[model samples]
Target chain A: MKYAYYPGCSLESSAKEYDLSIRACCQYAGVDLIEVPDWICCGASSAHATSHLLSIALPAKTLVQTEKMGLHQIIAPCIACLTRLKVADMEMEEHGDLKKDVETVLESTYKGSVRVRNILDVFLNDVGLEKIEKTVTTPLTGLKVACYYGCLLTRPPHIAQFDDVENPHSMDDLMRAIGAETVDWSFKTDCCGVSMSLAETDVALELTNKVLEGARDAGADCVAVACPLCQSNLDLRQKAIGNKFGVFYDMPILYFSQLMGLAFGATTTDVGLEKVIVNPFPVLGAI
Target chain B: MRNKLEEAKNIMKVAVKEDTTAFAKEIQRKCGQDVLTCYQCRKCTMGCPMAFRMETKVNELMRAIQLGLRDEVLSADTMWWCVSCETCATRCPQGIEIVEVMDVLRETAIKEDYYIPVESIEAFHKVFLRSVEAYGRLYEMGFAMDLNLMLKDPLKDADLGPVMMAKGKLKLRPHKVKDLKSVKKLFENVRKLEESRV
Candidate 1:
């Protein structure tokens, strides 16, 4: 199966490994990810913070482009972008005046012909767990991973409408399919502070620490994240948190795609596992 | 924590405006203007990573806002402590932009000149605005140094220091955008547009 793809800004830069893992998984899954032409930033965490219209317009531009291309479903790997796009879709569908107002600004009408799905949705729903199970060339035996949902992916159930808002099973099911253990953790849907990680390090640390500590305490060897921002904050900020609190819990935060890749017999380096700020060496050795 | 809570309450009492109708209206769309959906679930409080770091309950702050207890909402340490991860927003069944609501509360508090440890974050915003205002884009290095100096915490920048040092990325150099004059013009135009719209 093929679908249009929107790899938001973070995929292009901070989480390049996520982009790599997406390509690798798609290769194995037999899904063609056709990039949406002339896509702009999804007005990510900051744009919506600054203005309401820009947030809608930014994602609407891509939605309009998707409609023009005759594609019905688009896969956004980034959780923040997925949320923004989905929220925009909900705003337009729920609020008629907003749809008209946004349409006027773009000077083009959108027909809501597109559905935004996160990568987790694509693998679990579209591709089916049986397909994923078939591709498990190397089952990740005895690897414990904490599935971090990171708030945006399963919120305002009416908008995201992907999984159980409180207790999501899409990631867990996918992880189980790949032969990895998923932790029953409370902070799965907790926030990693996104842009605030950059502006407020202390705040970011506190948030990151809670998630890390929760996962660590829950007996997870590593944490699997679907969002790049969550990955960055958890993986990259660990050093600072270690330095800040004198607690060094070296948990390897893996992009969910990386886990899928490992299950499919791809090597760590092949999935860009070495690029993570927190060293995956300990877990790698354990495996 | 009790002393801090009393301090937070005292501070919020003076910080939030006595009249909250307009303030509430502006944020009503965010929380769906439904102030009654909160059944004291405390889901937000339990899951907030920074909740313990802060002195007050996020649920308490929302309840205070819903009750039109403007002084408490404004004065409480909750808004300032909010890291805006949207954990609360995501969990809130009433569909509150709890983070955005916190922003409005903070911005309102700032406008009212409520006392806060504003220097560090304020500097980041100032540097952000400066970059946007000057170059029509953000310059990471320049903004980085400006924020550090503003906070008077040179040690705060240690996180990126090592990476930049190893990669030879942290140069004490300022880079200007191409067509530098046009960037300045762009900023001016943007400012003018924002003012006119307001």
Candidate 2:
């Protein structure tokens, strides 16, 4: 199976492990992800927060490329990027003038035909769990994980609709398929304070603290995530959150892709496991 | 805790400061969310994770907009505090797309220069857009530096820089698109569109 890929800004930078593992997982699934050539930024939180037209137009520029590639679906690993692309595509369809405006802005015609999906959607629907189950060489039998969706994965119900808006389980189900024990937790769809991370660091830290505590309380060994923002907030800032709250959580916040890679016969180094901030090796070693 | 009754009285008193639907109509035109259909269930407020940080509750903000309380709504730091998690939008029985409403409010506040956001939120968005306009994708290094300059802090994230660098996570260069001319043109067209809307 072939699909278009938008690595997004974070995937190429801070969230490189996500990119590495997602690519590794897709390769094992026999799914070829062709990068959308000359694809621009998806306009992320910044575009949507400031300019409505810019939000639609910037992502539309990327969607226009997907359209030009004649691909039906584009895999945006970053949930924010996926949402932006999905929002832009939906806006173009919902509002006729907006589509014309985007066309005029980008100086390119967009068919609004690309289905913007996260990598989870690709694995869950396209590649099927049974196939993935059959391919698992290393069953994550002892690994107990809290599947954290964060936000934008199943939110803004009018747009970016993927799974249950409040209680999504695609990630959990995927974890189970790979032989990992999925813990039921309330903070699965909670916000990791998002863009406020850089600005209001404490607030983000507090939210991250809650998620980590919740996962731990619910008997999860580690937290599995889909979005880069969620990973950075929960993983990158764990120690900081610990420092502020005075409660150290050695909990590992791992990308679901990395876990999938681990089960799909890839080495820990190949999936970039050692790159996580909280040192997942300590926890994964016991498994 | 402060008296809820007194706060409600103050909110109402400030809300009547401007009784014009023109602002409401403009919001309807610009944001395109069905805020008028709100029955004040406060589900949005209840679902909002950042509600504690917001001066105006999410549902109250929607109600204020509906009642044309432009000044009260715009000057409030509620929109700035919004994390855009969309839990409010997701759980709203009215299907009001509250996150979109918050976006328009922030955009309006910035454009009209009504209430300057004290937080580094404005600087963050500006730097993010500038990075995209320049490189077609966010350049983390440049974004961090530009953010520092805008926030009047040269070495704010200086410590985290080295940590990120050692991990081999921070890409030194910005992500660039081949058709940068198109990206420039897109920004130009958006500016023109905004001017026309104004």
Candidate 3:
């Protein structure tokens, strides 16, 4: 299957491993990811939080390019990017004035025909669990994973429209297909206090601490996430969380694609596993 | 019980004005979310992850907007702290998208030049958009450097720089899209539109 890929900003930087693993996993799954040329940032949380017009225009420009590429479906690995793009698409479709205004800003018409899919949707729906199961070269037996769906992936259900907003099972089912045990956790779809990691470190730490503590309490070997913000808050800020709370919990925060890459027989380096702050090598070795 | 009834009677004695509907009408026009549909249900506040950090809770913010408490809602730090998790929107019994309401409030605050209670987040938002304006995508090193320099906290998240660099994640150079001029034009158009509205 062929689809357009919008990696967004984080994938090129903070979530490089997600980029690597997603590419590798897609290759194994026999899916073609055609990168949208000259794609701009979706403006993410900052744009909508600041200017309404810019937020719609930024993603509208990219969607215009996606349509130019003749791709009907596009997979955004970052949940935040997916939400931004989907919001733009939804706005353009629902409001003719917005579509006209965005087109004027973009200097191109937004057909709103492109279907935006997160990595989880691409894997679960596009590639299908049965197809992924057959491709699993190394079954992740005995590995208990806490599938953290953070916000934006399935949230504001009407916009995302991906899975059960409260208790999403797409990630869980994807993990199960790779022979990994998905742990039942309460904060699976909770907020990871995004962007606060930069502006409000304490609040971000407190929120991340809760997610980590919840995963640990639920007996998860590590937390698997789809969003770069979620991974960064949970993994990069773990040191700060431990230092502040005077509690140490070295739970590896991994991209769901990395685990899928591992299951598909891709080596650690292939998936950029070394990049993770809290290493999952020990746990992987044990299994 | 007598005191509560007296307070209710006193509140009922005050006349509602056309100005009270101005804020609610503007919000509805901007985001298509009807604040009037919110029936004082605290479900949004209860589900909001940042409610504890907010000066005004989600439900209260909704009520304030419905009541056209422009100054109260605009100056509060609640809208700034919202991460737009959408839990509030998803769980609202009335199907009101509370996140959209927060987005509208933030836009109104910026447009009207309201005194932002949380300046750092506002600063980050400006710096982030500036980076995207320059480069089609976010330049992490440049964005963080600009943010720290603006916030006067140069050493903030300084420790993670080397760690990220070692992992080959932090790029010193930005990946500008091929059509940089078009992106700039888009920004210019947005600026013109925003100015026209003003």
Scoring each candidate complex against the real one, what DockQ results? 0.17, 0.66, 0.78
TM-score of chain A of 1: 0.96
- Write down the TM-score of model 2's second chain: 0.84
- For residues B66-108, write the lDDT of model 3, one tens digit per residue: 8888899888889999988889889989999887888888888
| Candidate 2 residue B22 C-alpha distance from true site, Å | 3.3
lDDT of 2 by residue, A1-287 (tens): 88999998888888889999999999999999999987788888888888889998988888888888889889999989888888888879989998998888888898767888878888999999999999899999989999999888888766765888878999999999999999988898888896888867777887888888999999999999989888877777766876798989889989999999999989887788877877888778855
**Candidate 1 residues A80-109, lDDT tens each?**
889888888878888887787677656679
Stretch of 10 with least lDDT, candidate 1 chain B: B167-176
RMSD of 3: 2.6
lDDT by residue (A1-287, candidate 3, tens digit) is 88999998999988999999999999999999999987899998799988888999998887888999999989899988998999899888888988898988888787778988777877887788999999998999999999999998888888888889889998999999999999998999988997888877888888889999999999999999998889988998788888999878999999999999999999999999999988789989964
Best by DockQ: 3
Clashing pairs in 2: none
Considering TM-score, which of the candidate structures 1 and 3 is the better prediction for this target?
3
TM, chain A, every candidate: 0.96, 0.97, 0.98
Compute the lDDT of residue B12 as modeled in candidate 3. 71
Top-scoring candidate (lDDT): 3
Evaluate residue A39 in candidate 2 and report its C-alpha lDDT on the 0 to 100 scale: 78
- What RMSD, rounded to one decimal, does every model reach? 7.2, 5.0, 2.6
Clashes of each: 1, 0, 0
